[model samples]
Every structure is written in C-alpha cells, then in structure tokens.
Target chain A: MTNLSAELRQYLIITASYWTFTLTDGALRMLVLLYFHQLGYEPLQIALLFIFYEFFGVVTNLVGGWLGARQA
Target chain B: MNIGLALQVVALGMLMLPSSALTVAWVMAAQGLSGIAKDLNKMSAKSAIKFLVTDNAQGTLFRWVALLTGSKNALKGAGFFLGGTLLVLVGFRTAMVVMAAALAIVWLINLIALQSDLGKSASKPKFRQVFSKSSAINRLSLCRLFLFASRDVWFVIALPVYLAATLGWEFSKVGGFMAIWIIGYGAVQAIAPYLTGLRAGRVPDGRDAMLWALPLAAAPALIAYTLNSQFEAELILVGGLLLFGFLFAINSSLHSYLIVSYADRDGASLDVGFYYMANAMGRLIGTLLSGWLYQVWGLQACLWISALFIVVTAALSISLPRSGSTLPTTQ
Candidate 1:
C-alpha cells in the first residue's frame, strides 16, 4: 500500500467507504420490506416509507455536487 | 463522507428504538436521512474518481467506474442476505442495533482515512450550475431516469410481495433470490466492458446504449406475455428476472461509464450529481407505481410499465451523441 501512488490509495479508501454504505443501504431496504410485510402493511403503505428516501435523494444530488465542487 | 456515514448510523439508531416507538412516519424519516447520506457518499465517491484518473485515461476510468459500481451493487446483495438472515436469527430491532454499531466503526475509520482535499476543484462551481448545460448529459440523464424507473417498478415492492404472498415463499427464500439476482447482475456489470468489445479497443457510445436497450425492453414484455398465457408463474418470473438482470447490468454499466466520461473534468460532480438526481427521480416514480399498481392490478401491470419505460429509455438514448463521450484510452 505504501508503494502505490497517492491517487490509487485515495481511490481505495473511497471505494471501501462506498462499499460499506451500499451494504447497509441494501440490508436496510430488505429489512424494511420484509419486516413491514410481516407487520401486515399494505404494499402501497410499504412503498410510502421509501417515498421520502427517494425524494431527498433527488434534492441531495442536485445540491451536494455543487457543494463538493465548491470545496477548496 | 463522514457526514453521510454519521447520518446512516443515526438512521439505523432510529430503527433500533423499541418496537412500540417504531411508527411508520418515524421509519420514513429515518429512511429519508439514509437516502440523503447514500447519495452524498455516492456523488462524492464517483466525482472523486475523476480527480484520480487522468483526462486521457478513459479506458482506465471505465474499468474503475464499472468495478466500483459493480462491487457496490454486489455488496448491496450481500446486505439483503444479511438483513434477511439477521431478521430471522435476531429479530428486527437487534439487527438494527448490530448494523448501527458496525457502521459506526466504519465511519470512524473513514473519518481518519479520507483526505480533506479529495474532491476540491480548481474553480468554484455556482449553485445554478448544478443543473447541467450539456445536451449529451441532458439526454443521457433522461435515458437513465426512465431506465432505472423501469427496473424499480417491478423490483421494489411488487416482486418481493408477490413472491411471498402469491407463491408462498419464505422470507429467506425471497431475500435469497433477490440477493443472488443482484449479485449476478453486479458480476455482469463488472464484465460489461469486455462483453461490449473493450478488449478489442472499442469504447461504447450512444449507439451502444440504444442497442442494449432494445433487447432489455423486450425481456419484460416476453415475460408478461408468457405469464398471461397461464404458464407456470414462478418459472416464468425467475427466468424473466435472470434475463432482465443480465441485460440491465450492461445498459447500466455503459451509462455509468458514459456519464463519467462526459462529465466536465474540472467539477465532474456537477454533472454526475445531476445525472443521479434524475436517477433518483426515476426510482421515486417507479417505487410509487410499484406499490399502487401491484395493489390495484397485479405484478403484470408493473412488468408492463417496466417495459414501457425501457422503450422510452431507448428512444431517449437516440438523442445522445453518437460520437464517444471521451477519447478511448486503448488498454
């Protein structure tokens, strides 16, 4: 790891972080799906739980990129 | 990145509260936080890649983007399996506590490992610039929006519920099947460049995107037709799902590569972010339709909607520039 360039090392770190995030994200989705179904929620009701999640994702991407770009 | 990780921990913590306290609205709120965290981390990670790779190294860029996207998806599949197994083994609240604790540890490590200046750009981009100005980007974003919407329409709420309710599969079976499908999808995505002639020094363009969509659009349609004809529902669905996962992975990988290639090198996050915003919007619409359509009509309706969206995606792909988004760095 020490012999690799700075960029390669940085990429690895980012990838590792992203991997952990994705893992949790996927698991959470399944947990919600099965748990709520077990609780007898309607399909639409289950979908509603994710509405805000997807909605905020739209907002975050639009603004987050600009913030990332402006960072010095 | 740290903020995103911290938010995820908090989201999990919210779920860890006692069952009586876990109201629907509360879970939604927690999910909202997780959503924000996921996109922030994703946008930053993707944009950061532009900084690591030279402008001329587009082949390397494609490989890196595919690997990251593919591996992330594969990990997501593992997460699904973990979620299912944990629920059966320890129950929901316990699983939440375990995940939150684990993610908190990962967060602390990333806090120290990530450099402060990772995605800092030479020029500061303004808020208004967040909306992309490039026609190529705009077209690709449109395709991406519909493409993702098509998948989520069937995959999100409809498929799992259908598998469990109608087919009488166990939670573990449903979750396991979904996990294997996604893991296989990710594997295909990782190898998409090789399948599409990257080995022969051919870099994909808008034409490739269009070509891939044509077959994907047909897959769900065929499934829907077979199911309507009183064929074995379980067999048809499983077969359709495998076909859909394979074709969709290639189309998705191509788009991932194109977006990174087309993004402005100076502040690549701007374009990548806008593109994913459309992607999120697609998921939003598809998720909503998945629930409503499945409740009112059935899984077939969701499959039809998916097919329609893919057709729209193919149409939109036509408007993207036929010329490659970036110069191919021959490996």
Candidate 2:
C-alpha cells in the first residue's frame, strides 16, 4: 500500500467507498421490500414502493453523465 | 458529501418514524430519494474506473471492470441477507439507524481519504453533447434498454413479494433465496469473459452478444409455462431463475464491456452515462410492469413480458457492428 502510486491509491479508495455504498443500497432495498410486505401491503402495493425509485433512476443517469463531463 | 448527507437524513427520518406514518406514499417517497442517491454513486464510480485502468491493456480493462461490478453485486447479495437479519434481530427502525450510522462512517472515510479531483476533465463538455452521436452507440443503448427490462421485469418487485405472498415463504426464506440468486448472478458476471472465451483472445462482438442473449428469452417463457401448468411452482420458478441469472450475467457483462469500449476517452462518461440511462429506463419499465402485472394477473404475465423484451433485445443485437461504435453502419 505504501509503495503504490498516488493514482492507484486513489483508485482503491474510490472503489472501496463504492463497494460500501452498494452494500447499504442492497440492504436498504431488502429492508423496504420485507418491511412493507410485513405490514400487509398487497404485492402490487409493495411493488409501488419502488416506482419512484426506479423512475428517478433514469433521470439520474442522464443528468449524472452530463455532470460528470462538466466537472472541473 | 452531499449524497451522503442526504442519505443520512433520509435514514434518520425512517429511523424515527411512527408506525402510522408508514403509508405507501411515505415509503415510496423515501425510496425515490434513495434511488437518486444510488445512481449518483453508481455513475461516479463507473466513470472513475476508466481513469483507474491503463489504456493499452484491453484485457486488464475488461477484467477490472468485471471485477469491480461483480464484487459490488456479491456484496449487494450479502446486503440482502444483512437487511433480513437486521430486521429479524433489531427490527425496522433500529436497522435504519444502524445502516445510517455505517454509511456516515463510509462518507467520512471517502471524504478524508479519496482524492477530491478524481474525475474532473480538462475541458468541460457542453450540455448538448450529452447525447451520443454514434449510431452504434444509439443502437447498443437500445439493446441495453430491452435487455435490462427483460431481467428486472421479473426480478425486482415480483419475485420476492410473490414468494412471500403465493408460496407462503417467510421473509427470511425469500431474502435468502434472493441473496443466493443475486450472488450466483454476480459470480457468473465475474467469470463471463472466461465463459465467452476471452482467454482465446476473442473480445466479445455483436455476434457474441446475440448468441448469449438468444437463449435467455426461452428460460422465462419456460418458467412462466411451468408455473401456469402447476408443475411444482416453487422448484420450477426458483430453479428457472438460477438458469436465467447465469445467461443474463453473460449477456450483461458483454454489454458492460462494449459500453466501456465504445466510449470516447475524453468524456467517456458521456457515452457510458447515455447507455446506463437507457438501462435505468428499462429497469423503470420492468419495475412498473412487475408490480402491475403481478398484481393484476400473476408472475406469469411478468415472465411473458420479460420474454418479449428479450426478443426485442436480440433483434437489436443482430445489427450491431463487430467492434467499436465508431464503425460504419454494417447495414
């Protein structure tokens, strides 16, 4: 770790953060899925919980691309 | 910093909420916010990878890309089980608090340790350049849309809910199966190039893409038929999903490689971003259809729609150029 270049070290840092984020994100989905179902929301109703989640996902990808390009 | 702050806020809100406040509208709103945060993190990390790898080694590039994505997915599978276990051990509100605290730590680590100027470009790209001009890119993006929709249509909303509702499986059991399903999917993704013979020095081409995707359409169709036929619903659906996951992983890894390969070195994010936008749109479409179809008809309808989407994906793949999106139209 000490001998690696700054670029490689930075890469590892970003990758680690990304990995942790994914873990929490997955956990969040399961938590929501089972929690709502436990509360007796119908299957479709439970599914509706993520409608906005997935919809806004499309919005983010487009805008995030542009944002990534413009970043200084 | 901003996304982390926002996620922490949302998590805290969920942590302290009253039972009566847990309306469909409330949870949906929260999920929407989380979705935005997820994509922000995803796009940034994916864009960052191109910078991390050496330009000359296409093979190493492919491997790194697959490794990053595959490992993230495997951890995500673990997260599913973690979520279930947390719920069982600590219950909902406490689980939210614990996750929020952990994420806050991640945020702090990233803030202090990672370089601030990671993906900044020398010349800022104009907003109008956001859309890809390459017809190959446009065509591949279309294929991506249908391909992801094909998977999410059954995977996202319908499957876990169905297991719990129809089969009378417990939440732990549903989560466990899903964790296994996703872990297997991610594992297949990690080894896709090998399965496709990347070792043979064959970088995946459109023909490879089509061949990988063609068999996928059949699995869902068969699964749906078996369920409709009432031939041991649990075994067929679960087993069928595992088969579907394997094929879908290969098809998806091929696309992942292509999108990175097709992207312009400068503003690579622009192309990768456009492609994933389509991917997200597919997920959006599939998620909605999964809920509505499962509610109105059953998982059978979701499976059928999935097969239809895959057929469109295969159609689009047939015309893709052999290499980069820069190639002249094969037509």
Candidate 3:
C-alpha cells in the first residue's frame, strides 16, 4: 500500500472520495423524493424541495473553490 | 485540506437528520446543502486531474477525463437505484444514516492520505476570476448551456409525465426506461472519444463537434412531426429519444474534453467552475420552460423548442476552431 508514488495515492483518494459522495447524493435524493411522495406530499412540493439544490451547486462552483484556495 | 470531502460528509449527515424531522423547509434546506456539496466535489475532482496528468499528453487527458466523467455518470445511475432500494429496505432515516456512515469512512481515508496543495494556483485568484477570461472557454460554456437545456427542457417534465399520463405506461416502466437510457448514455460518453475519432493521436476539434451535432438538430423536429403524423406515438418518441440520447452523449462528452483541454493550467477549476455555472443556469431555465411549455402548448411544443435549442448549439459549434487550430477563437 505504501509503495505507490505520492501522486498516485492522492489521485486514488480523490477519485474514491468523489465516488463515495456521488453514491450518497444519488441515494439521498431518491430517498427524499420517493419517501415524500409516499407520505402524500404533492409533486410540486417535492420539486420545490430541490429548488436550491441546483442553484446552490452553481453558486458553489463559482465561489467555494476560490474561497478554499490558499495563498500558494 | 480537501474542502470537498468535508462538504460531502456534512451533507450526508444532514440528509440523515432531516428525514426524522420532516418539515418542508428543513428538507429544502438540506437539499441546498447537498447541492453545494455536489458542485464542490465535482469541481475539486475535475481540477485534480490537471495536476495529476502532464499537460503535453493531450491524448491521456482526453482518455482520463472521459473515463472520470463517464464513470461518475454511470455511478449516478447506480445511486438512483440504490436510493430507492435503501428506502425500501431500511426506511428513509436509516438509509440516510447508513450512507452517511459509509461516506464518512471514505472521507476519513481521503483526509489521512491525500496530500495538500493539489489544484491550488500559485497565486490567490480574486473572486472575480471565477469568470474566465478565455474567449474559447466563454464560447464553449455558451454552447454547453444550450446543449444541456435542449435535453432537460423535454426530458425533465415533458417526457416522463407524457409517458405516464398520456401513454398509460406504468410509473415503474417509465422510470426503468429513463434509468436504462441514462446508464447507456453514460457508457456512450465514456467511449465518445473513440466514437468521435480520438484514435491515431487526434483530439476532437470544433469541426468534429459541428459534424456530430448536425443531425442532432433535426432529430427532435422530426420526432415532433412524427408524433403528429400518426406513427405509433410511443415508438416514435421512445426511438427518437434513444437516438437523441446517443448523439447528445457524444456531443456532451466532446465538450467536456474540450473544456479541460482549453482551461489554463493553473487553477483550472476557475474555468471549469464558470462553465458549469452556465450549465446549471441552462438546466434551471429549461426545467421551468419544460413545465410551462408543455402545459400551454403540449409536449410537441417542448420538443420543438428542444429542436430549436439544438439548432443554436449546432450553429455555435461551427464557429469553433478547425482541427489544427490551438485557440478557441470566436467565429
């Protein structure tokens, strides 16, 4: 495990982390949408619950990556 | 040092907590956080590629980016199915908890192993720098915006509801079809480079995009016409959608490679970030229009509008550089 180059190790970590996050994000969305539908929430209401999801995603891409940048 | 991992872990926990306390506002707020988490993770991961791969290896870059984008999309398909299965097996809150715990472990490994300073530019980029200065990037971003809108405007609201309400197909059938379509689309995207002629050491050029997107513009228009012409509505629409999906996947995968190829080496995330912002805006606009247009004019109208958007996308693709051109000069 320790034999790989540092760069290779970092790459693995990033890909693994991204994949893990994707699984949860996908599962969680389905969980919410289906669960709420079963609980009698209106379709419009279900859609509304995700209103900020895409919006926030755009905002994060534009700002958060910059904000996290260290003075290299 | 990886801000993306933190956001993702927090998002999972938030999902777990919100299920038991199901106020509408709370759920929406959690979704907002999840959205932010997603983009952060996406930006971080993609930008990491630039640092990992050498710049001179354009072929490697294309392959790697295609692999990453393709696999992520395929996983997203799995995630969708997993979401439903978890809900059925463990209920919502428990499902969230289990996912959260699993992601936390992944996050932990990332923290312990990943070296800091990856994807950081040599200088601190001003907040405004998120808006890319590259004319090529700007143009490509515009094309991407419309391309995605063309898909979601019809696919999001018009298609599923139309199939369910109008065609009398079962809900599960509709979902299964869409899921299969998405997974297939992802698979195509992974192999798009080969399909679009990435072999023999040539990368996709603007002309290739133009040639690829040429037929795409006519597809929906033809489908909409066929829908009115009395051919089996389900057959025409479904078959048209499948064709559209394949073409769109190719165009989209090419664009993804182009963006990474065009971005500046230092802090490539800025360019990537700006591009995806346009993408998200397009989706938002398309989603709104999908519902409205379908309501006011019917699904045919939505398809027509989608055709119209693809026309503009095709036009934009033409102005892109010839195969040998290095810069994305505006035509």
Measured against the true structure, the TM-scores of the candidates, in listed sequence, are 0.82, 0.82, 0.73
Query: Per-residue alpha-carbon lDDT of model 3 for A1-72, expressed as tens digits?
Result: 344366667777777777778877766766676677667665456556777886776676455545444311
In candidate 1, position B238 carries an lDDT of 97
lDDT string, candidate 2, B255-292, tens digits: 87776555532224443456658888898888878878
Worst 10 residues of 2 chain A by lDDT: A63-72
Give the runs in model 3 whose Cα sits over 4 Å from its true position: A1-13, A34-46, A63-72, B1-24, B46-67, B87-91, B108-124, B127-137, B157-175, B198-208, B226-231, B256-276, B291-299, B318-331
Candidate 1: regions farther than 4 A off: A1-18, A66-72, B43-69, B108-125, B130-136, B201-205, B257-274, B320-331
Worst 10 residues of 2 chain B by lDDT: B119-128
Share of real interface contacts recovered by each model?
Answer: 0.81, 0.80, 0.61
In model 3, chain B matches the true chain B with a TM-score of 0.71
lDDT of 3 by residue, B1-331 (tens): 2565566567567666644577788878877777867776776677777677664378976786667776886677677667767766778878777887787777677666666666332333546564576666777788888988898778766675577567876544555566667888987876787887775457777777778887887889999999997778788899889999999999998887777666532224443456757777777667667767876787899899998998888788888655473433333
DockQ of each: 0.58, 0.60, 0.48
Clashing pairs in 1: none
Best by DockQ: 2
- Considering TM-score, where higher is better, how would the candidates rank from best to worst? 2, 1, 3
Question: Comparing candidate 2 with candidate 3, which one achieves the higher lDDT?
Answer: 2
**Model 1 error, position B241 (Å):** 1.0
Interface RMSD of 1: 3.1
